[model samples]
Target: MSEYDKVRVGRLVLKGEKLKTKKRKHKKQGRDEEGTTVRDEDASAHGGWWKTVRIEEITGSIGIEFGNQTYVKALDNGLFTLGAPHSEGEGPAPEEILTAIKVNDTKIALKSGYGKYLRVGPDGVVTGRSDAVGAMEQWEPVFQDGKLALLGCNGCFMSVAQDDDSVVAVSKTAGKDEIMQIRSSTARENENVKELPAEEQGSLAQVEENYVRKFQKFQDKKLRINTQSRSGLQKAREEGNLHEILLDRRSKMKSDRYCK
Candidate 1:
């Protein structure tokens, strides 16, 4: 049996030297009810983990926290087990952190620190030995009634084993023990914001027609757009005069009511 399989969950504790806690000086002061001044600490500085409520938000590094402060930690042998309990405001350890990739809209794949993908073996043990993600490597995070549970490809819910605390997928239905939190760092800003298309960014002929329809006063209600060679317009766009050029085109067509 592997070291992870023989290890008991209760006996596990954070290994290696303790991480030094970063201290910050609060510049702002606040008055308490007793009229005493106190330093106002930023809440964001204390914790970096944010609960991932949506599957689409499960990108980048993540920590699977369950049963108090315990997390699912990746072992060197490509196996996973319940890690040591962490204090409040403490982030997960390096081995406890895993890279999460959104496989699709409903499925995701977890890559351990060992650079292996996590998948359920035939024995239902959650192991990270696969080099590539397949159907068995894809996992679905089920969220219901404000509870989160991970559903493996084998149609079993992932949970910590009671005997050894090894991560496994065996239960067909998710219960209290299956409820877990997937947390990510708060450094991701605008991660879900997609770039707008050229037409949507008002850089295409279709966008010109849309502007004309919104602001143009046509007697026949027909949309009119400049169909001539757009080489000059493209140059104007490069020179930061595209809007002026578009307005000039509208004026020549006598279609813009705002044009004087």
Candidate 2:
């Protein structure tokens, strides 16, 4: 099955399309080896919900979000924390990844990367790291259609509502706004974050510095005498590309010593 990930708060959300396979009218006809693709209406009649996706707490963090003095971590610890784990950016705390295991009860155990389970109590408080499994260790998966939420044994829904700032809390009411869009580490191309490579970055910075300096020294006093430079500048302004600003004349910035 194709791996799927849900969109997050700060991430761009795009419309997703799926191929719906239609049912063969004749029972004798075997299913196509290559599968088939049909219109959206045909797929709906076949009772297709596509692949079921749920809110799953992972057991490991693929990577880290670096910062100067602080970092949010806890992927493999069976508990997730959002704060500066280190006083300095040197030694980063271990990330505990989580995976959900559906035990005998309706509750599912969110197994941590270290084999521990994340559980909530009647007070809607979450904790982990126990050798034995109990009712308190199980979490009931709550779903608002595609939006996934968790209703712990505490009778409260897991939420990061603005109502509280104390790490993980389950007291949040089951509202659409409270649903957290936990994103995976799957690499995505974001235009806004698409930075130039190191070489390009340095080149761009240097070019800009050169441009500002050149403009600062610019004047129209010699416009008639230096028609070539003027025309080059004009062309540069019109084209709005490299040459428009970086004139072909390499010695454009040289001092005018007026040598015979």
Candidate 3:
């Protein structure tokens, strides 16, 4: 008898002959594809609260405030729109917050809540569909006088459509509608960290010794430093000629091998 017709009338199902069924993949609740929890607390940790007043402070996680009480928000469809206004004191919603990565001194890239890099399309519509940053994903924040605007890589200024509140980059020149503010949670005190040149970093005596150690040939293993007035050194440092003045001092001491 054919194997298909040989089934016993009773419960004689063969071992290992059961139907192979696929395990159902239940979608995770409140979690993105990357397994990150989509909660307001996670957005807050990414600097979603404070308002950034300066352009230099526009790094890390930030929000673009387009209009009064309205912020540029990312949508599930990978597009941006001006979100509904919130209370006067409340900050942007979780979807309105984005990660701003400084690509260079003049350009920055933004990543939306969906983990996609934002870019301007040929139609000037802003979309966040790229998985990684590219040339088109870069944006320049132009600050002039007391106003700020975002310039897209397409040479258009980002502006909100008055009809639909959609975020688009259509105008080459930034107008009143294009002005926007980027807010962040960075402390104001941390913005201006004092930086000094290597030669003038420490106390005056230490500054002198640092140069001496760097240039001194020390044939007899004895350090020789210029004990003359450090006023000229301080002046040179202020005038941005500290290196030349330090080299001259080492040359006068007959210590630096390269001074000759």
RMSD of each: 24.2, 24.8, 21.4
- CA deviation > 4 Å runs, candidate 3: 1-54, 190-260
Q: lDDT of all predictions, in order shown?
A: 0.82, 0.44, 0.82
**Clash tally, candidates in order:** 0, 12, 0
RMSD of model 2, in Å? 24.8
Give per-model TM-scores. Answer: 0.56, 0.36, 0.55
TM-score of 1: 0.56
Q: Estimate, for each residue in 1-260, the C-alpha lDDT of model 1 and write its tens digit.
A: 99889977653447885667679988745333333222223223225677777887788989898966678999998889999987777778999999999999999999999999999999999999999999989999998988899999899999999999999999999999899998887555554444443343555676577667777887788888777776786778678887788888889888788898
Per-residue error at 245 for model 2, in Å?
A: 67
Candidate 2, run of 10 with poorest lDDT = 42-51
Best by TM-score: 1
Greater lDDT among 2 and 3 belongs to: 3
lDDT at residue 245 of model 1 (Cα atoms): 82
In candidate 3 the C-alpha lDDT for residue 198 amounts to 62
List residue ranges in candidate 2 displaced over 4 A.
1-79, 83-96, 121-123, 161-166, 181-260
Select the stronger candidate by TM-score from 1 and 3: 1
lDDT, ranked from best to worst: 1, 3, 2
